[model samples]
Target: TETLTNRDNHNYDDVMDFYLMDNGPNVTGYVNKGFDVHLDDFYNNLTADKKSSFFLTALHESQHTMGLQHPFESGFDEWVHNSKIDSTGSSIMSYNERDFNGNNDLRIYDLAVLHYRYGVNPNARSGDDTYGFKNFEQNNADGGVYIWDGAGVDTFDASNEKDGNGVYVNLTAGSRIYRGGNTIPNWTNKHLGLQEINGS
Candidate 1:
């Protein structure tokens, strides 16, 4: 992937270019074979909460290069619904929002595809990490998140969340959890990582 600063004299032959421009309506960014990624200038116009930032847009577009498609585009709505997984809320590929506003990480479905394609990264988030409202907000993981920790003791602390009464706290991957008053996808390997789930 190439980040071109000089679009005036840039070459689009063998590299994936990421740049900003006024592409069209409702189009934030797009990718060509995972090599070329273009973000619309509208990204600069929207509020921070509404726009997932150019970094996330680039991440979404980059997934296209890996041959991933939107859940609706791939006709996976039935599965998505049956499984109780909101693609737009959990996957970056979707051009919609369901939960809080936007997500920062790869979410559940995106991780599934990535793990299938390149296997799981055993070193992701390898630290004494915590998952909760403040943690998610600090990281801009509003949409949802999938915790793939490699090592160290981890925790899922929702005790500080006042609206976490009916929140489901599961240790299995792909289960939905409540965060910021909204139920969203959040999975963690409890057996391998998280040792406790402190709920409200």
Candidate 2:
């Protein structure tokens, strides 16, 4: 297995997006082969609730090193939104809650995705198919909500609804949510909402 390292200051310069290599490369701030879960300003800028969502996302990305793609689905984009544990809400692989991170309620399908990627065949749906925090819900209000102090606004709720907190929502109907307002899309065409916190 490779170790993960941190590359916070290490610049890629003009490296391409994806590098084809038989073995993984080294990192700077994280352990080798280990996923470098960056806790940058972007992450800090997220609300406590959003922060938890991203935490779970990091876990999902870490699992990718084991070779897992988003779970299989039938529809092009609809598949992800449709594939739920029991049709209650979005799947860990779904776009709506892709930013959610509730370590306590890690899903079996998510675990199964990791298992399949790692080549470890655990029972398809083991004990308690129902796991994770069901109480955690994304704020669907309007305007902007507070994520972190120096990081600034993370998500924009265009819905105009109050998202539990006093802050208004900033997310628009067709617009995607991003951290630090970076336009680059992340996994599954979603945006990375965490920013690098200075002196962290």
Instruction: Give all TM-scores, in the order shown.
Output: 0.50, 0.31
lDDT tens readout by residue for model 1, 54-112: 66778888877654676654345344553234444556776666553545666656665
Give the Å error, residue 56, model 2. 2.0
Q: For residues 1-200, could you state the per-residue lDDT of candidate 2 as single tens digits?
A: 33322223332232112222223233211112433333233554568877765555555444443333354333234344333322213234443443432333434344333322232323433333322112334331111211211122233333443344332223332223343333443333221111121121
Candidate 2, poorest ten consecutive residues by summed lDDT: 191-200
Total backbone clashes of model 1? 2
C-alpha lDDT values of all predictions: 0.57, 0.33
In model 2, what lDDT does residue 23 have? 30
After superposition, candidate 2 runs with Cα above 4 Å error: 1-40, 72-81, 85-91, 98-105, 116-200
Candidate 1: give the clashing pairs.
16-35, 34-65
The alpha-carbon deviation from the true structure for residue 189 of candidate 1, after best TM-score superposition, in angstroms, is 19
RMSD of each: 11.4, 19.3
